[model samples]
Target: MVDVTELQRQHIEKITKEKKLITIKECSTLTGIGERKLRELVHVSGFPCIRFGKKCMIVSSLIDEWLINHIGETF
Candidate 1:
């Protein structure tokens, strides 16, 4: 399994705030990762997300950590 470096985890942890929930569009804006791609990732098992009625919400820190873990991926 891919692991997040300490530095990357620290950066991601720092972004975790009291208002931890975020919309998919906000996630895309903050990460520079498109909404469609985020949507795809959300469906993967273990990908952090909570279904709120018809909306899918995610924890900002979880997504950040996930992105860090995937940094070395190709395509």
Candidate 2:
């Protein structure tokens, strides 16, 4: 049987693999945007992301540029 905690650990490991690509959690930490809000923002056009299975891998640079464009130059 698959333990729930084990599944969660794998998910965490997948999301935090340490690279230029990062997960919603890391993006949220860097951008101060809530994870749920970040997920919603993903549906917007031209939001840079990659999908591996069910995980949404966000590019740190793209999100930064996105915020600056959408929010304001001050962002």
Candidate 3:
């Protein structure tokens, strides 16, 4: 049987190393935004995205820019 803990650890390591792109869940966590809100912002405001096969990933750099630009401003 596969070791679930090892699998999770590997997944975490992969994500940490590939910081350029992230899932909606990761983006929401990093930006402190709800998943629904993040999706709306990405769709309406043209938030940066990186398409990988069938998945849509957000660029971490763009999230950093958004955070810097919106710092101290109420969401």
Best by TM-score: 1
Please say which candidate is ahead in lDDT: 1 or 3.
1
Worst 10 residues of 1 by lDDT: 10-19
RMSD after Cα superposition, model 1: 8.8
Q: Write the per-residue lDDT of candidate 1 for residues 1-75, one digit (tens) a residue.
A: 656576656654465564488888877766778899888878877777888887998887687687777788743
Lowest summed lDDT across 10 adjacent residues in model 2 is found at 66-75
Q: How close is candidate 1 to the true structure, as a TM-score?
A: 0.67
Evaluated against the true structure, the overall lDDT of model 3 is: 0.72
Q: lDDT per model, in order?
A: 0.75, 0.74, 0.72
What is candidate 3's TM-score against the reference?
0.57
Sort every candidate by TM-score, greatest first. Answer: 1, 2, 3
Instruction: Give the range of the ten consecutive residues with the poorest summed lDDT in model 3.
Output: 38-47
Candidate 2 off by > 4 Å: 1-18, 72-75
Q: Summarize candidate 2's per-residue lDDT along 4-56 as a digit string, tens digits.
A: 87876666456546566887888786677899988987767788888788888
